[model samples]
Target chain A: MTYLLKQLGREWRFMLRQRYVLILLLCSFLVSGFAVFTGLAEVAQQQQTIERLKLADAKDRLEAQAKYNDPGSLAYYSFHLTYSEPSNLAFAALGERDVYPWKHRVRMLALEGQIYESDSQNAELAQAGKIDFVFVISALAPLFIILLFHDLIASERSSGRHDLLVSTAKSKYALWGSRGIVRFVAVVLCLMVPFYLGAMISSTGFLTTLLVSIWCIAYLAFWTVLSLWLGKKLASAPRIASILIACWVLLAFVLPILSDLLINHSVHSAKGGDILLTQRETVNDAWDLPVSTTMDAFAATHPQYADYSYQGEGFDWGWYYAFQQVGDQASTDMSNDYRAAAAKKYTLAGYATLLSPPLLLQRKINRLANTDALAAFEYEQDIRDFHKALRMAYYPWLFGQKKFDKTQLTSLPQFEDSTHNYKKVQNEQ
Target chain B: MNNKKTQFAIEANSLHVDIKNAPILRNLSFQVAEGEIYALLGGNGAGKSTTLKTLLGFNQPSSGKVFIAGQEVYSALDFIRRKTAYLPESATLYPHLSAYENVQYFLSLADIKKSEDELNQAFQRVSLQESAWHRQLQTYSKGMRQKTAIALALLREAPIFLLDEPTSGLDPVAIDEFNQLVRELASSGASILMVTHDVYGACQVADRIGLLRNGELVGEYDAPENGRIDTEQVHAAFAQRKAL
Candidate 1:
């Protein structure tokens, strides 16, 4: 143990003397620090947006409640705020939160259009992505690792010190092993110190933080071992570095992109825009159709409301709501297909991670942060569930089964995020 | 030359080494007894460095065996390395580090600790200028870097030494100082095997000189009872072998 410590200490001191090495380590620290800062800011911005929208939603609903005497008018005017609150660890990953709509304000209208409204906006921006901690680790940390380790052995040989150092050292571990460990530890520390600070500030759970650290270390070990292995086979530092950089490019960028294209081609599903268009067109066409047609379609799903009659000649509230319900029902099949395709694509990407370690790390941390595509899909489902609660609360009054009472407004359904349940289940696992 | 002991500190017997299917050393045999300096003198491609590397276990012998301190090199590499200190043709110690730091780092790599005064003494013994001791090797000349490497090797205090062109870049004065140091190390019971093309330098310091040509040891010469080996005789042999 004493010998190992001495060897490590010696290499640590030696590494500090090299300006290029110190610069690389500093760059790693700064880049990772910047990533953590941006991630925290982004998550804070998202939470702030959610809080702001909640206030406005409550105020708007109270005003609508004051203006409308009837349940149908109130349900039509009152918008409930549904949002997936960013997880504590989301400050690190910020995964699909940028791509998926995490917050939605929906009224008792056709649900599909409201859900898919923001899908196409700023997609290019999201694709470019924010500099989150996970991006720093999975994508950028490997390059830092490569720069640090690719020349571990070759540099010694180039300097004509390989033979002397090897022959003089008491053991191989005392020489190369110590040097490699020192470098690996330095790079890992540089990359993870910022993340740990972020975790503390975000109050990320201990187990999640540990898991993120283990995954990052394991991923870095993959690069470290690979660089050393290639260094052994190839004597030239530049050649070894070229091979490692090529590998980084292939795994971090090319494979993920190609697999995405292949998965999209193979997995057929309705697009979000298609779902929105289908629901909107159905709602538009309902104006020309007979009221009976809309009510008949709605009654097929809600048989309990079938006995209610729409006696009003022009613009009955019950008929208007029934047609809106029918519009959602018309697009239900397309919505399910879109979600199923998205789920399949996510699953296929999970398998592709075996080919690309960076993708695997990104996926793992994103899942932990509750910002993955799975999390986004769950949020959409939560909105749908909340919409169903809204419809249930108002449908009885619309169908004349219950008296319209302003005092009962306090008992109306409110949007509650199901992300807590998901997190609970995740923690248990 | 008279203080040589019978116990061999380094031994290579019938050693064969092939690199990329080309023979680097062929059936080579030699021994350096305790308190003796043996120099392998040859021109380029004569496999002198290869022979030195073989003794250090950097290259595995295709056949036969090498032993340092009476232990087979391949089976006891850690022991061999601990017992040996090597000086390469070009002592490219970390250029970013001062001479003191490079010596300290390499000695630490050997798991040997030295007091600051001891380090200063080793630098002083190598005759590296006091002014250059704390300067980074990058700013130093070739001879200064070589002196730093010599200081590191001396600090190892190992039983065996392997020197590859140990005086390749030194000035005439520095070369004489290095030769004197080698002689002093040998007198202090260390065994050394140096590979160099400098016939006169080898004759000046070596107790015994081996002439190598085309991976084979062609001739061996020993100093007379009270005199150094004749430099003219060895130089003639080297020149004639080049003609062949």
Candidate 2:
């Protein structure tokens, strides 16, 4: 053990003297640090946005309750805030949150339109992606490793020191092995130290942090061993570097993009805009249709309300709400198809990750942080569940022809995000 | 061969080496006894460096055998490396390190600790200027770099030495000084096997000289008792062989 430490210590000091090596390590640290900083800032901004929206949503709902005594008017005017809060580890991954709506304010209206509203605005921005910790580790760390290790043996051979160093050293471990280990350890520390600091600051769980570290180390080991192997096989430093860089570009950028394109081409789905348009058109055209047409459509879904009749000639709350629900029912097939396609695309992307380790690591870390597409889908489902509860609570007062009381507003349902509930279950496990 | 293996510090018995299906050294053999300086003199394409590399265990012989200190080189590579010190043709030590640092780094690689004073003494012995001892080798001339590498080899204090074009960049005075050091090292029970194309340099210090031509030992010459080998005879033979 003493001898091993001595060998590693010698290499450590030797590596410290090279200016290019020092510069590369410093650049790695800076890049990793910047990524962690941006991720933390993004998560913080998201949490703050959720908090601000929650307060405003409460204030708006209170004003609506004071203005409307009828259940239908109160439900139409009040908007409930539902949000998927960032997990403690989300500051590192920040996965699908950038592409999906993490928070939404919805009234008792057609919900598919509200859920898909922001989807069109961020398609271009999502393609570019944020500089999060997962991105730094998966895509950029390999380049740093390739730069550090691609010349481990070739440089010695080029400089004419290979034979002399080989013959003089007591063991191979004392020379090449120790040097490679020192370099690998240096690059790993440069990349991971900032992540660990961010993890501590975010209060991430120990087991999650450990899993991330293990995965990162394993990923880096793949690149390190590859660089060293090619360095040994190849004779020129420039040639080895070129080959490694080409590999990085292929695995990190090309494969993921090609697979994404293939998956999109293979899977067909209804767009969010189409669903929004279809639902809105149905709701808008319902006013010109006969009263029997709207009431019969609503009664098919809600059989208990079949006996209830609207006595008022115009602006009856029950009739208005029935058509609103029928609009959602009209777009239900398209909405389901849209969700099914997204879920299928996500699963195929999981298979595609086998072709790109960077994508695989990103997926794993994002799943750990509960910032993946699955989590987003769950949040969407949560909004739907809450919207259903709201309809159940208000339909009785609306169709029963009973006198409305303002005090009964307390019985209205609140939105609870499934992401938070999932987190709670995970913590319990 | 068996008798020589027991008495010699370095031995090659009918060694053959092939690289990429092409023969480099064929049935080449030589031995360097303890406290003796043997030079393998050859020009370009004569397998001089290949022989040095084979002895250092950098290249494996396709057939025949190479032994260092009576043990097979391939089987006892670590032990052989520990017992040997090699100086490459150009002495290309780390350009980013000072002469002292380069020597210190190489020594530490061998896991042999040496004092600063001892390192300074090695540099002084090699006639490297004391002023340039602490400067990075990138700022040094070729001769200065060669001197630094030589100082490192001397500090190793190993039993066997393999020198490939050891004095390639040295001036007349430095060459003479290095030749004197070689003699001093050999006299102190170190075996030296050097490969070079310099006829005069080989004649000056080598106790015995082997003439290598196209990977084969073409001729052998020995110094008379207490005297140097004849330079003119070896040069004429080398020129005659080159013409053919």
All candidates' lDDT scores? 0.89, 0.90
Pairs that collide, model 1: none
lDDT of 2 by residue, B135-224 (tens): 999999999999999999999999899999999999999999999999999999999999999999999999999999999999989999
Please provide TM-scores, in order, for all candidate models, with all chains considered together: 0.96, 0.97
The reply for model 2, stretches above 4 Å from the true place, is: A401-403, A420-429, B1-5
Please count the clashing residue pairs in each candidate, in the order shown: 0, 0
Q: For model 2, how does the per-residue alpha-carbon lDDT over A321-352 read when each residue is reduced to its tens digit?
A: 89889999999999999999999999999999
Q: How close is candidate 2 to the true structure, as a TM-score?
A: 0.97
Task: Give the alpha carbon lDDT tens digit for every residue of A1-429 in model 1.
Answer: 977887888889888878899999999999999999999998899889987877787788888888989887888888888889899899999998888988888999999999998977868888788888999898998899899998889998997889988887888878889999999999999999999999999888899999999999999999999999999899999999999999999999999999999998999988788889999999999999988899899999999999989877778888888888999999999998898889889999989999999999999999988899998988899889889988898888899899989999888876777774333211100
Interface RMSD of 1: 0.9
Model 1 residue A34 CA deviation (Å) reads: 0.7
Model 1 stretches astray by more than 4 angstroms: A421-429, B1-7
